[model samples]
Target chain A: MTEPVTTGTEVPHGGTADKVFPPLDPSTVSPQLVWLAITFVALYFLLKKIAIPRIGGVIEERQNRIQRDIDAAERLKDEIDGAMRTYEKSLADARGNATAIARTTQEKLSAEVDRERAEVEAATAKKLADAEARIAETKRKALSSVGDIASEIAGPVVKQLTGKDVSADEVKRALTAGAGE
Target chain B: MPDPIHQFEVKRLFPLEIFGVDATFTNSALFMVAGVLLSFGLLMYASRGRSLVPSRMQSVAESVYEFVAGMVRDSMGEQGMKFFPLIFTFFMFILTLNMLGMIPGFFTVTSQIWVTAALAILVFLTVIVVGFAKNGLGFLKLFVPDGVPIYVLPLVSLIEVISFFSRPLSHSLRLFANMLAGHITLKVFAGFIIMLLGAGGAASAIAPLPLLAVLGITALEFLVAFLQAYVFTMLTCMYLNDALHPGH
Candidate 1:
């Protein structure tokens, strides 16, 4: 094989180069670090000051709204309890008033009935007294008439039976005395 | 003519040296550029039309977005949304590098420790800075556990601090080691095929088997590449989680 050689250039033929692997040097730092730092700082600040805060604010506002809703519910519950208490008290008051009115009405009706009964009884008693008085007077008149007739009959009998005839007035007086006895 | 490790050598396309630094454009540099350009071009093309019902390209783009988005959300919560751009760029960049290496002549940037270390450091510094900014001196409380007994404070804090500092080291090492091991294994198997075929005669017949193994390992390497990238991002999330809520 004819090998072609270049002037003044020593190319190693058929072997690996002296440098097997690249040198591992710590000094060689990527310049991208500068830009990376800048971007990182800027983004961190932006998020901390603006983006994160906004998200946090939204979360806080939601929490606050929930708390407010809960508080409102508690207040409403209290109001309902108050209203219930008022309703219960009013019911008691209404019941008491109804009972009082019922009692007063019963008493008024009973008193009115008692007065009417007494008036009826008094009127009946007066009528009965007047009738009794009339009967007594009629009885007295009949007895007096019977006594006069008896006296007339007794005067005839006495004249026949006795030697001397008795007077009509004296015979009427004796018959009246016997009838009264 | 064929050596196992020979393929990894960096060759300068344009020979230029500046102050002892080989700033000459190389194959590795070329592939890196290609990876960047390819990634940008594909993403741009995919995202060109904003559609309610996604086109094929848009769907691909959206899928990539959603995959990364879900990872971030799962790992970091809503706070991770802020880091979307960084994590997205990191994932795409590493993914492109890994996929690009599967091409015949392309280089894998993530295989290099320097590159991975740089990325690890970036995440490390970001976590530290963010922790400090958010919590101030309270960031130091991360080293002190809440329920530790008063008598064990010294011992516990020492252990905690050491563990805390090991984050970047482990993060960088895990990616580098995985990539290095996979590439080396692939090269070894590939070298077996070459060595066998070069032996000629009946030995050439056996080359297909090693080649098949290399292919299988390459596929597994591809899975490892994605896993490493995922692990790196997940670790970053965990670190950030610590930064966000220290001592937890």
Candidate 2:
């Protein structure tokens, strides 16, 4: 704080506040403008010709590539959906066909079993009818024979017990009456 | 030890006079070239291997591209894309110059009002040329507000014209003043550190405080460097927008 702080005035150069402050300085304006123009125009052309286009191109390329990949993914997804639909359709069709085949086979087997059962029943009925006819015929013969025996036995016993011979007409009449009783 | 402003002195690096004009290439010119070369080198190197997946430098390039692109596109619409190169060039130039000034002993090119004003005037001239070329007689409509009464139209038009003409002044002064003031502030604070240290033992202890402030301001100045460039580019876009759509 003791020593005075020197400003731009003592710089020994021409660029002190006295000259530089009036931004409209005649000496510095033209050169600065000239250099600025030269460099700026050069820089502009450099950017236009090289820098911007390359950077912009690469970014645009990347974006386009990403879009293409997304489109491909969407297309593949659609294909998968189509394939799955077809597979499901075929599976349903196959299941229906199998069910139809099973039902027809089941119907045919049931019809065949019914026919066999009917034939077996018819044969058993015929056998039963023959056996019944035979039993009836035997029963008729036995009844007729029992009647005759009864008559003959009755006449002999009567004759033995009474020690008298009975007439055939009387014996027949008595046997008939005893048989009726 | 002499003066902080002494740092702003423009020393001629090469003496060259053309057509009886003192066009000796000065330190300002040197840094101006340096700024251009730095920007070109950075951009060229960054964009050399233009990759889909950007490398670090590639990202830097892409970021700068998108940043300027967005500024031009948002403010001026698709039609404004034509000015991207110019705006980008200006942004890079000013940004590089501002940053160069931050170096220990480099010249702050933007701190020179003439330099900044020249850039502003260039933008101003471009706006005028483009405005008239695009809109013809309609460019004058920029001075006439749509809602103003006929009687007050003259007054409003004068105000508009004044404001329109003031664009270059404001644009150039904004950058120049900011760079100049920031440098001056830094130099003054930096001067404090030396003065405090010069005061010897006890004062030197407090010198670190100003040194700390210098560090903070230096960081702020770095941000200002980028922001000023951005502001200049944004304003250029806005002015260009006025040219393109001169009706309102």
Candidate 3:
């Protein structure tokens, strides 16, 4: 199996060195080729069956993790949007309720004021009518009393002055004329 | 009488020789050690700070890493990340060895059949082990083409097996042959320039033509060094892809 190495040159006087470093025999193949084949086959199996799959699994897992993170971000965004919408709606509802309450209170206060005014007007009108009636009655009483007292004093004077006249009616007429003068 | 082959003989530097084994350090061993040390030291220094914002050295390191990384990803897909370490190591080692050879007095390890063969064998073995572990007995299906008639299975399987077995041989030979042919051609052309100059007078003026050719070949060899390393790593990814998916 030990072949003479080619020196890239031709020489004349080939001696014992030619025999020692013989040209490689083409007919006789080297066994190293067989060993190389065996080694190659064994290595291929080990890598394909074990190492590649493990590495591939790691790659796939990394991709899956990235995808999951993206999905989680999307979910969080949706939740935040929903919460914002709910908050806005509640705030609007609260404002609407407050406005309604304000309007109702305004109306109630106006109605209450109107009712109180009407009641006060009614009481004042009734008290004014009673005062007017009392004044009219007192005036009538004062006018009748003055006429009766004047007539009584005037009848006594006429009776004494008109004795020869004979009748009470004639005496009353003369007393009225004296009193008027 | 000078032996032409003796020009290629390697000499040891150290005086320590054990049992005529010539264990003393040689030019090839020196370059190999230099390549390994240079690669390790450069990478360590480049990645020392490991900053988020890269320095100049870190940028260079990152570019190399990303280049090889992109190659693996493009050839083998996302699943290729697992093989990053092995693929990166192979690319760096071959690249270092190839580039180191450009320096004067340094030997190119890839020019040797044993070195390239060893690398190829490692890749071949890795693919096989990976394929079997992945598919179990079903890994044998790689040797049997799907959709073939049962009558033709034996022929197809045999061809497939032969082709599969030929990978290491082709892989090794490709690197070894390119490096060997390139260096030899350079040497031969350089020898011409020397021979012409030694003739003296007007003949020395014609030496520039061969000298120019040597320069051109040297540039081409540099390109080849990088190309060969790239091709080797690319093929490794392809084999890894096969192991991952046997029939496909």
Q: Write the per-residue lDDT of candidate 3 for residues B1-248, one digit (tens) a residue.
A: 12223323333444333454324454445555666567656866775665555688866876776788789999889887789767876777778888887765566767766567878988999999998998887788889888999999999999999999999999989987887777778888888898889999988989999999999999999999999999999999998988988876
**Clashing pairs in model 1, backbone N/Cα/C closer than 3 A:** none
i-RMS for every candidate? 9.5, 2.5, 10.1
Comparison by lDDT, 2 against 3, better one: 2
Residues B68-173 of candidate 2: C-alpha lDDT, one tens digit per residue: 9999999999989988888888888888899999998888989888888889999999999999999998999999989889999999999999999999999999
Task: State the displacement of the C-alpha of residue B215, model 1, in Å, after optimal TM-score superposition.
Answer: 1.8
Q: Which stretch of 10 consecutive residues in model 2 chain B shows the poorest summed lDDT?
A: B1-10
| Root-mean-square deviation of every model | 12.8, 4.8, 12.0
Q: State iRMS for model 3.
A: 10.1
**Model 1 segments beyond 4 Å from truth?**
A1-20, A23-181, B14-24
Q: Tens-digit lDDT track for model 3 on A49-144?
A: 543343334445556878899999999999999999999999999999999999999999999999999999999999999999999999999976
C-alpha-based local distance difference test score of model 2: 0.84
Judged by lDDT, which candidate is best? 2
